[model samples]
Target: MSPVRRQHVILRVVAKLLIPYILLFALYVQFHGDYGPGGGFQAGVIFGAAFVLYGLIFGLERAKAAAPPRIIEILVSLGVLLFAGVGVASMFKGGNFLDYGVLEHDPLAGQHLGILVIELGVGITVTAAMITLYFYFAGRGRA
Candidate 1:
């Protein structure tokens, strides 16, 4: 194969290998939300950024092949639904919207669960939305 195509293949292999670790770190951030700044928003961006970087380095077509728009759309909606669902649950449970303390018999546990869920939702939304935008911009750039 040509040097340019060979380089693409090499870069793709490296990116695929690193993608898993990046995703793992994002999960770690999601889980660590109970203690630190490494919560949903940061985690989501961090997660999406890896893929975006992959696209930039390899090709937008490769990125889109990796993460299609349909998938991103579904993920974005899921995140919003998850957030609203938790809020509605809190409302029904006699607390303000998103007050997770109502989720369990132990209000503190409920709070922790609620925070984790909502933080996850936030992370998903941020990641999906950012990815979708990245795709659009990258696609435009390609044109």
Candidate 2:
């Protein structure tokens, strides 16, 4: 099927309207995760879903233009590095790997910061991976 044929006025309008709300919720989940059940994984999925929805309604090329492949690849790597760097930083602080207690002068603050950083890294990686997967699958049959 031609990519242009996928565009429908209603679908595009709905998607455009919903995408912001979805992203807003994703941010909420990411930030509120510390006190609730939601976290990086859920937030990432939600964020990715918005883009995937855009692709489904708009087109893969447009989606790709919105999140270029090179930028996505960098994000994937950067996320992993951020996660690992946190662990390594803890080690340097004379704490065990993944030790959040050493991240700040106050143990509680340190733990909170560590968790935030870790979750952010995870969210980034998951978001990039999901978008990458969508691109690959969507591109499969295209000429």
Candidate 3:
């Protein structure tokens, strides 16, 4: 991956500037997904992408410092848990699993929020899993 990426101070600076906002936007996308085309899954990918690029340039250790393995693993589980937990919560609130209506005082709005949160969860988990997998095998079979 590092070999594939062209290294330049400008690109690194650009990436550094963009990464935080990208992650922040991912959060916005995750939370506001009900009314938009974005969702947690997409947000996760976008979020993970920043670090992936970072790793490609600076090496895995720096990337890990940005997002530690333990934290990433937890985030991976947390996102899934959040999605599933919402589903279960909805079930108890007289709706089917993942039904958003039970999420708030207003069922319609609740649905929107619920979907956003769940999608964000999916994104986080997926992104973390992908990065983790990449790193896990990144060092293997490389000359």
Candidate No. with top lDDT: 2
TM-score list, all predictions: 0.85, 0.93, 0.80
The residue pairs in collision within model 2 are none
> Model 1, range 1-143, lDDT digits (tens) per residue?
23575567777788779988998988898889779769999999988988887777767777888898899999999998999999999999899998888899999999999988999899999999999999888788547
Candidates in descending lDDT order: 2, 1, 3
Model 2 per-residue lDDT tens digits across residues 70-91? 9998998888899999999999
Error of 2 at 84 (Å): 0.8
Q: Relative to the unseen true structure, what is the Cα RMSD of model 3?
A: 3.4
Q: Candidates' lDDT values, in order?
A: 0.87, 0.90, 0.79
| Candidate 1 TM-score versus the reference | 0.85
lDDT: worst 10-residue window of model 2: 1-10
lDDT of 3: 0.79
**What's the CA RMSD of model 2 in angstroms?**
1.8
Worst 10 residues of 1 by lDDT: 1-10
